[model samples]
Target: MSTEKIKAELRTEFGKGAARRIRREHKIPAVVYGHGNEPIHLTLPGHDTMMAIKHGGANALLELDIDGDAQLALTKQVQVDPVRRVLEHVDFVAVKRGEKVTVDVPVVTVGDAAPETLVVTENATVQVEAEATHIPEQFEISVEGAEAGTQFLASQIELPSGTTLLTDAETLVVNVTAAPTAEALEAELEEAEAEAGIEKDEPEAASDEAAEDGDSE
Candidate 1:
């Protein structure tokens, strides 16, 4: 992955109020830590940092200029405001250029399974180790013409050279299953109704018995 160059300012303020102030200024508060060093608090440009992450990834390389000091880091975590769709805080793990780090890479599916077979993904991402500066954008798995009951295991995936899988080799990643039929849907509905205390048909004589009891009272 290509490194995204961003410029940040050293944060002098702290706490939730300071963070809100930074967000109000359209900036994102972040901390850079790792390598057994003290975490440095900083504020990054909101738009630029977001765009960089969109193009790159959570583990993407970032070349930061903080107070004129060049820093090499990788984004470790990002917090967002769900309602406002704004970035809240970010965590950056400082690293050297040639260092290797373990990260979860998104799993992308390519191609379609065979007719009448549904390819169900069991995992959306897989953990792997790679150079911090050269982490993969994403990995794709092809399900072309896979039949029902076909399963793709983690060990079956072809990894890019130099990238090591950090997950279990025998872990199942995808499962192909046959789609439910109309009869199956009806049976499921009936079972659900029974479980929910729904009676499909009630005898009129039973209802009349309750009505007669009410009249007697």
Candidate 2:
């Protein structure tokens, strides 16, 4: 993955008020720390940072220009407004080229399993150690013509050169099973409802009560 170039400015202010002021100026408050170094607080362009992250996945390597000094960093964490979905704060970890870093890469499946088979993905992502600047955006697994009773384990996954899996090798990644029939599905639903002590509501009875309430009002 190519490192995204982002311009940053050293920040002197701190606290909620200072962060709000930075957001008001269309910037995001961020901090970079790693390798036994002091955390450096800074501000980054809001739109540019957002775009870079959107284009490159979460582990996007960033080239930060802090007051004309260039530093290589990786996105460690991002805080966003829950409702607005806007960037609130960001945490970056400084990294050196060729250094290996551990990160979670998304697991994606391609192709289709054999007919009458159901594929269950047990894990959504896998942890791996790879070069800091060349972390993969995701990992792909092929289930083409996979038969029932077949399973894919973490160790079986093909990793890129120089990448090592950090997840347990015995961890189940994908499980293939015979697809349930309509009757089996219905039976399972009934069993779940009985176990939960839940029953289907009577829509006609509900409508009658609602009509009576409207009449009284």
Candidate 3:
């Protein structure tokens, strides 16, 4: 990952009203805290920040130009409006170049497993320690032609240069299993329905015959 430069301004106001005001101006309310220093409140350009983070992957390393002074920061938390889909708030931790940071990087699987096999990702992300500016976007594990019962553990992942795995070595990350056939699926569904006391409807031939006889009379 590369450091992205974004312009930021000091935020003097506080409270929900102030945050709303900042958003109305197409800016984002954020705070930077780290290294045992006082938290610095800031307002960042909404569109620029969004683009920078989007391209930077999960944990974006940014060089915030606050009033002409540059500070390297890493994205720690982000809050967005669920309905409006707009950024509501962001939190950053100040970091210096060459500093190592612990972060959870996404685990991605490449290629498909063997035919008629089901692929399940048990742990989608694994914790790693790496340089702040050189953090990897994701870790990819190849599952091509993998047989059933084959399991990939965190220890099996190939780490990037200068990256250390923090997750447990024995933790299961991906598992390949045989896919259930249609008959097997139906049987399981029936078993579930029986356990739930759901009786399947059946045709009542005797009752229908009695109704026919009464109608004839």
Candidate 4:
């Protein structure tokens, strides 16, 4: 949970054209707001900010140096260009050192379950409250040697110090079930197709009839 240092410039420009201009210069347009303060528009180094987030995850803490005044902020919302896969804009929330913020932490699994068992993840992320500067990047759950029919609940997850789970305790996180055999899988697929009223195409007969009609014509 290290804070990344980002030098930012106060921006007076607004609108789409201005944002595009900023991005063309290898900078990203961003807004910072929180704690009863006015939203400040600024520009950050595009490559640096992107690298920090990639290394630190979504909850990356940032030490923003704006005109020599340093402020601590948390990465809140990020907008990206889907086609180009580039950072379009970002929103930061001002936070103090000891303040607790609620965020969704990604859930990751480690190890393997019993052989011939399928592992299903019910939740990919869980909400939690933690110190803004020390938010955990992710939660890891070990399923080593877990047998079939085993289930994991949110309450059973281990949290880091000073972190509290905000998700429902009864919520299912992971489930281990017996894997379907190849024959069973094929049967299930057939059943699903039947239920959906999907039938095999009778293209050969239709093509023969079309040829006969064309010959008669």
Candidate 2 regions exceeding 4 Å error are 200-217
TM-score, candidate number 1 = 0.88
List model 3 lDDT by residue over 1-217, tens digit each: 8888999999999999999999999999999999999999999999999988888878988899999999999998989889988888889999998999999999999998999999999999999999988899999999999999999999999998999999999999999999999999999999999999999866699779889999999
Alpha-carbon shift of residue 51 in model 3 (angstroms) = 0.8
In the range 1-217, model 4's lDDT, one tens digit per residue, is: 9999999999999999999999999899999999999999999999999998778797888999999999998999999989988889999999999999999999988999999999999999999999998899989999999999999999999998999999999999999999999999999998999999999676998989989999999
Instruction: List pairs with backbone clashes in candidate 3.
Output: none
RMSD of 1: 3.7
* Poorest stretch of ten by lDDT in candidate 3: 201-210
* Clash statistics: count for each candidate: 0, 0, 0, 0
* Candidate 3 segments exceeding 4 Å error: 191-200, 203-217
What candidate 1 gets wrong by more than 4 Å, as runs, is 196-217
Cα error, candidate 2, residue 123 (Å): 1.0
Model 1: how far residue 188 lies from native, Å: 2.8
Better of 1 and 3 by lDDT: 3
What RMSD does each model have against the real structure? 3.7, 6.1, 2.8, 4.4
Could you tell me which residue pairs clash in candidate 1? none
Global lDDT scores for all candidate models? 0.89, 0.94, 0.94, 0.94
- C-alpha positional error of residue 135 in candidate 3 after TM-score superposition, expressed in Å: 0.8
Superposed Cα deviation of residue 64, candidate 4 (Å): 0.7
